[model samples]
Target: MARIAVIGAGMGAMAAAARLAVAGHRVTVYERSATYGGALGAFERDGFVFDTGPGLLHLPAVWRDLFLKTGKEPLERCVGLTEVDPASRHLFADGSAVTLPNASRAGIVSALESALGAGAGERWGDFLGRARDAWDRSRRPLLEEPLWDDWQVLGRDPYPALRQRRMLRTRQAATVTEVGALELADPRLAALFEGCALAYGLDPRRAPASAALLPYMEQTFGSWYVAGGMRELARAVYERCLARKVEFGFGSEVTSIVVRDGRAAGVELAGGAVAEADHVVAGADTALAAGQELWEDGDVRPQGGPDAGQLPGRFAVLLGLSGARPASAVHRSVVHSPDTGAEAAAVFGGRLAERPTVTVLRPDDPRIRPDDAHEAVTLTATVTGHGGAVDWRDKALRERCAEALIDAAGTAVEDLRARALWHEILTPAETGAVPAPSLAGLGGRYLHPANSTRLPGLHLVGGHAHPGGGLAHAGMSGALVAGLIVEGADFRGSQ
Candidate 1:
């Protein structure tokens, strides 16, 4: 049995550890933090709770498959997983609104048509049909398997754009922004189409038409909320790893990757102690940043800085409110910004929009709130990452941003400002980790580096690696890494 050394106790790392252990490998995970679940964290104060990371989970089959593979116990048995109905309620800037039903195409269309007008739903439904085509074309290579060696083929856009005659030449959408403008035809529908990309911190203007896969997946598969918090999902995975006899070294930070004879020999910890292993898998971005040379020249380098797969810093305003959450309120509501173009420029350009799009999450779970009489609300927005043009560290700036979000939430929640007993602002500086999902177009600018590295016995997993980020993608990443190690490079994917 190969002794595998994994870096980081993040979801991806833990997932890999569990699978490797089940495969009879002696896996030891080294974590820098005291806890698992890198971005999947929670905040608790005076009985009020909030998920510091993603509020809703899409593509839950990824985790369900993990549970099915790792243990006899299913995912539902571990967490109170339920589909969030009225998938999302969107509050447009023009005061129009619509609550889309969970995973029901007809329901979503009818609701959109009722709210926005007769043709609104039809246009969106048609767009979704096309988006479905995109999903079918890109699903396997992008999500279900390891990234292709000639990933350039995957770089070629899979989104089949409807060609239109413009003068003497036929035209098709190159970017999602164009797709919205040309096909959706209405500003609201356009916003709905673009919002999907923005939710992943990708600018719609630059995001490839293939990004249609994400929204299509969400509408078809449905969005879900964990009972306790997203952290519970992480807890379930960690427990599964322990169940498989995977060892963990919490508080033991990997200082460097120890290489001997041009192969990854093991990992050196923070205190100069070396743990020898047959293979090393990096499930966190820390390993990439901590050791750059491990990746030889021409390897898929994880880029940083503004606009280079560097996600906009998240500005989350967690509100502890005094009234019971209204039964009529949907679990998630997105209050759209009046101007998406300007908002995109501000957010991606290292500046903050005065009126940014805010996603308000009000979970019905009692565990997150003090009681039924009180409610816990989380308002999140994509702004400039910390140390950019906007200083999230500035208290006054943060307060102003919080106030702006409260103003936005007021559109969705009644008495939002007045109901708040207290408010806590989590800036990009505070919550450093943000979601980054892999997209399949724009010449593969959004695709992550391959899982296999230049050096033998070294593999990559997690958001920064192949298949990209997001909870579901991270799980898929772990499965892919485990497959590569267990079955060799010939492993195609999950059948």
Candidate 2:
């Protein structure tokens, strides 16, 4: 059995720890906080509970597979899982809205036709068809496996953008923005298409058309909500790791990864104590692992493009409402900004939009509320934070941003201000920005570093690593890292 030291008690780290332990490796997880679940955090006050991280789960089969691999009990047995019907309701700035049915293309197409116009749904459906093609082409290399050494091949966009002929000039939609305008046509439909990209902090103007896979995955797999809170998913994974005999050191922060003979020796703690291991898996930021130099020279380092440093911190505003959730409420809704272009510019420019696109999540779970008379809701928007340009620490600034979210969310929740008993704002200061899942285009700028780094015994996993972010992709990150470690780098994921 090999002694493996995993950094951070995040979901990805714990997933790797569990799988490694099940493979007979002695795994120890080191987290700086007093708890597990890096980005998966929760807030509770009185009887209200809220997920500070991702509020919904998509492609839950990933976690289901993890649970099955780690133990006999499946994911459903560990946590209360329910499919969110009407996957999401989209409110365009044009005052037109459409409620998308869960996992039913026909239903969604019909709904869009009713809400937008005769050919609107057909156009959106056509786009989804192309998006599905993109998903099929890139699913293997971009996800479900280790990022290849020749990842540059993925730099070529997989999205089969339609060739449009205008007079003598032949035009093909290259970026997501062009796809929305030249293909989707209607401004409302365009916002819905680009809104999916914007939610991940990807600027629609620059994000490659392959980013269409974001909504494709969601529509195909459907959205799911965990009972209690999303934090429960973290708890279940942490418990699974424990059951697999993976040890955890909660309050133990890794200062550096000790190197011996140019391979990963182990980890050095905050107080200079070393925990030696045969291999090291970094499920957190590798920059801080060894003075921001661990990935220098010939290593597959983190990308720092125009949207760099880190993806925009998921700016969340948790609301504690006094009224009971309406019986007709959908699980989630996206309130598009009046001007998405300006909104993207503001986020990338280190500012907040006057009317930003806001995603409102109101799960129909009693575990999150004190009683049927009360409700807990979360509103999220993507904004720049990695750079020091935006000061999130300022209370006044946070409140101003929170107010903007509340105002923007008014479309989804009636009398939102009056119904609120209290509110909590999570800025970049508390949660830090989250990386989106790797996209298959933009000259591979959207792809994450390979899980197998140039550092021999050191591996990178989690949202910031291969397969990239999002709950499902993070699970894949853990799996890929474990496969590489256990199978000696020849592992190419499930055949």
Candidate 3:
């Protein structure tokens, strides 16, 4: 059995470690923090709990498959899983609203028609057809397998071109914004689609129309929530890793991947101790790892693009309210920015938005609160991920941004400000404080670094690697890495 050393206890890294150990390889995970689950963190205060990272899971089948492969108990048994019906509620800038049913295209079309207008439903339905085309064409290549050697093929936009006579002059909708303008042809509808992309940290203005797969994936597969906060999902995976005999070294920071004789030998710890291994799997930030000299000479450097040295981060506000949640509350609600074009300019080109689109999450689960008398709410918006550009250290600035988000969420919740007993602000300083996944869309390259690098015994997992960011994408990265190490580079994918 190969002795494998995994850097970072991120979900992706641990997922790979568990599978590799079950395959009979001896594996150990090293994390800088005292806990597992890198971005999947939880916060608690006075009996109130909040998910500091992703509040919901999309395409949960990725994790479901991981559970079945690594252990006998299915994912359902590990955690209390529930489908979030009326999947989401949308509040458009135009004062119109729609409630989308979970994974029901017909229901969504009807809701849009009733709320927006007659043709609106038809228009969205038509867009879904086109979106399905993109999903079918690219899903396997983008998710199931490792990024191909010639990943440039993915850079060629897969969004189908429209044949309308007036649109004939244009070859196709090149970017997601163009898709909204040319096809959807309504400001509200465009905002709806763009809002979804922004939540994933994609710049809707330049992101490929193929990014439609974001909403399409959610609508098709359905959105799910764990019994408690999303933190429970992370805990479940961590337990599975332990049961599989995968060792975890918390508070152990890796200084560098030890390279000997031109291959990854193991890892050098912060105190200068060395743990030898036959292979080293990295699930840390790709750019940071390279800067720390984790790779030998001529080994591939992961970050090279127009978006050099920058990854988008999230701004969040967690609220602990004094009142109990009303029965009408939906699991998630997105209040679209009043001026999306201007908001996009600020996020992709300038500073943070003065009035950004905000997503509010209020799970019905009672585990998040002290008692039935109290409630928990979380608000989030995507911002430029780098901490250097804007100083998140300023308390006044964080409060202003937090207030702006709370105001934007007013349409979804009543007396949003007064009802809060207290609130916590998590700026790019906190969310971006940790090295989260970089959304890959610079210069039309959707693919991140390949799992197999120039070094023979080194592999990369996590959102920084191929298939890119998000909880589901990170999980997929781990599967691809394990498949490569066990079956060799010739390994196509997991069976």
Give the TM-score comparing model 2 with the true structure, all chains together. Answer: 0.97
Tell me the lDDT of model 2 at 149.
Answer: 72
lDDT (tens digit, per residue) of candidate 3 on 284-312: 75442353444444332455322443656
List model 1 lDDT by residue over 320-382, tens digit each.
999899989889999998888888888888887899889999999999998999999999998
lDDT of 1 at 63: 93
lDDT string for model 2 (385-438, tens) is 745688888888889989999988998999999999989889888888767778
TM-score of each: 0.97, 0.97, 0.95
Q: Where in model 1 is the C-alpha error above 4 Å?
A: 286-299, 305-309, 433-435
Error of 1 at 405 (Å): 0.6
By lDDT, rank the candidates, best first.
2, 1, 3
Between candidates 1 and 3, name the one with more favorable TM-score.
1
Candidate 2 segments exceeding 4 Å error: 288-300, 305-310
